[model samples]
Each structure stands twice: as structure tokens, then as C-alpha cells.
Target: MKIKLKSGIDGLLFGMREKDVKELYGNPSRSYKDDEDNTIYLYNDKKLRLTFYADEGFRLGYIIASHPDTELSGTKIIGQEWPALEAQLQQNGLKAFEHETFDSVDNYFNEDNWTIFQVEFGTVVRVEVGAIINAKDEFDWKFK
Candidate 1:
């Protein structure tokens, strides 16, 4: 899948319904409400997770890509070390403006559209992209 900042992965844009997903990728491997009561669709074969919240019109709000082949600007995300990831970000004209490290895990977040990368043991474990929730805690559907 290709990551599109402030937009979506590939053709699955924000504010799309579940049926749109089903039409594009068939049925999910698993679907359920998460701990926070947000709906979740796990596509195991694609190593992706989709999250939707009722308050957001139940539209697709987040995407978690864990597949090593997941590409962003022609660079693979998962399994990339921080240095490599940083380089990829720079090369793509994207930036990780904030970062934190805890318990040997590194987290990097892009301020633009909230693409987060979680790295463990020196390699990226997963990358998460989501719609922009503004400072007032309102969904910035303008990005759609």
C-alpha cells in the first residue's frame, strides 16, 4: 500500500464507508469494536488495521500498516531503522518533527497528518496514519 500524507493509503481516502473498503479489498480478516469502542477491521493478509469512530461519522479515521513491503515514496517502511526511516522521510519531503523514546521503543510522529512510526529493537514495527484531529479535538474533515 502507498501512504498519502493528509490523504490516505492508496485509494482508501478518509470519510469513506466500510462498504467502500469491502469493494476495494474484499472482506476483512477480522472486524470488531476495539477497547475504546471504535470499530476495527484487521486485514491480516495486508498487515493493515483500519479504525473508525462513531463520532467521526463512522468513517475511516486511521490506518496501521505493519507490512514490511508497505511503501511510502518508494521506500519500504517496516523493518527500517530510525536512520533509514529518517532519510526516507527527508527524501520524500515529509518530516518527523517530534519523537520520543521509551522502554527501548522509538516513536516518531509527523505533525502534518499524524503519520506515526513505532520502532522496536532498531527497526520499524509499524506505521500509523490518521486523519487530522485539530487542537480543539475536532475532526479536521477538511483534509478529506
Candidate 2:
């Protein structure tokens, strides 16, 4: 589930909490405040920034995932459980994705034999991809 997102300065302006911002992003390399009482978190390497107000609701004033001055990279999905993830994506009406097959699908799966399926969501978007077990496995499971 790896996908790239659009980056714009206006995309940064929003109302959200500092903790919520932290939860969405891992952590900030630096933090500061402004005259308007907005708390700012900056993650330079990731090209992300979040600003929140101190008042109740901690209104998120701005969020700059990537500056207009730079190019942004897609999000990476690693250490994810592929099978369940694929199902979840399907459930989300993400059928917008297209599918592709690997030439040696079975070999990459580390299985005795396998069939692979992949779903693509536009360009550089999160897609669901997985493998299928043959009738033999299904038969064995039914018997068990």
C-alpha cells in the first residue's frame, strides 16, 4: 500500500491537534511558536510541517507535507500484512485499481507454487497485490 500524495502550500492550512498531527507523522525534528500562538512542528527530511493553535480544539492551522519549493515522494508501505491488507483495500471501494501479473509470481512468494495478482490505483498510488492458492490447498483446508 504505497501511494504518493499531492503537495501544495494550501494543503497545509487546516484545523487539527498537535497530537493528531504527531500520530499522522512520526515526530518533528524541531518545534516553535508564532505571535498568533500557533505551535509549529517541522520535519525537514520528510518535507512536512504542522501548525496548531493553543486554544481549545488546538486548531491545526497549517500542514505542509512538501513545500512548493520541492518535489515530494510517495508514501511507502513496509512491514505490512499483504493478504489482509488487500482485502481491506477491496472493501474500501478501492476497486479503482487495475491489476497486473508477475512473470514468475510463484517463485517470489516462497511457496511450493503460487499465483500472484496485483491491483494498481492510477499512477504512483497505493495498490493491492497478492497471491492465490490452488484447488489442492482449498481441498486440504476443507477436509481439515
Candidate 3:
């Protein structure tokens, strides 16, 4: 399925209610509470991770995708090489800003939106979409 990375993914926008997620995904493969006390819903078979903030009434905070089939702007981002993905994103008029990573991984985040691509050995393995607070502090910031 084509997932939009505009403000969220697959109609699951940030700030959405947790019950909405359960209704859409029909129960996650696994669920757990994180260190921050947020409940994380994991659909490993679907390659999706959804996090809801406890303080915000369990509203959706982040949507993560690691599936090879997930597409962004008509391009399959997960298995794409760094150069190819970079070119595709640029062609789509999306500006990518490189994020610091301790390991041998290359991370690029879109300046215009909450889209992040995690590349290892030149191939993208993960993509994250969420709000800036969740993206920066909760997700990508740990890499820096």
C-alpha cells in the first residue's frame, strides 16, 4: 500500500486516538510500555511500530516503518540505496538533512516533513514519520 508521509502515515495522523489505531490495525502483534511510560504497539509482521503518549491520553505520537514494501512518493524507500533514494527524494522536491549516527549508519531526515530514512551499508532499512517532538527527542535524537 502507498503510505503518505505528509503529516503521518496511512491515515494514522499524529495526535490520533489509540482506539483508532486498534480499530485500523485490528490489534497489534505485540504491545508494551516504554521507558517514558508510553504504550508502543508493534505489528512486526507488517513492519510497523506505533507509539502513543501517556500524557496525551494515549494519542499517537510516532509511526515507524521498516518494511521493504512501504512506499513514499511512489518509491520503495526501505531497500533503496543511499544515492538512489537521495535522488528520488530530491526529484520529489524534498530536502534531506543528514543526521549524526554513532554506528556505521547513514540517516537522512526531510526538512519539510517528519520523514526519516535510516541507511546501513548504503541501503535504507527504516523510515520514521511523526511530529518533531517525537521525531527529535523520542526517535532520531538518540542517534545524535
TM-score of every candidate relative to the true structure: 0.87, 0.35, 0.84
lDDT of each: 0.83, 0.39, 0.77
Q: Over the stretch 29-72, how does candidate 3's per-residue lDDT look in tens digits? A: 99999999999999978899998888767878678889888888
Regions more than 4 Å wrong, model 1: 134-144
Candidate 2 local lDDT, 22-79, one digit each (tens): 6766578999987877687887866555556565346553344323233222313322
On residues 71-144, what C-alpha lDDT tens digit does candidate 1 reach at each position? 88888888888787788788777764588999988888887868898999989999999987778987765334
Instruction: Provide backbone clash counts, one per model.
Output: 0, 5, 0
Best-fitting candidate, measured by lDDT? 1
Best by TM-score: 1
Instruction: List candidate 3 stretches off by more than 4 Å.
Output: 132-144
TM for candidate 3 is: 0.84
Better of 2 and 3 by lDDT: 3
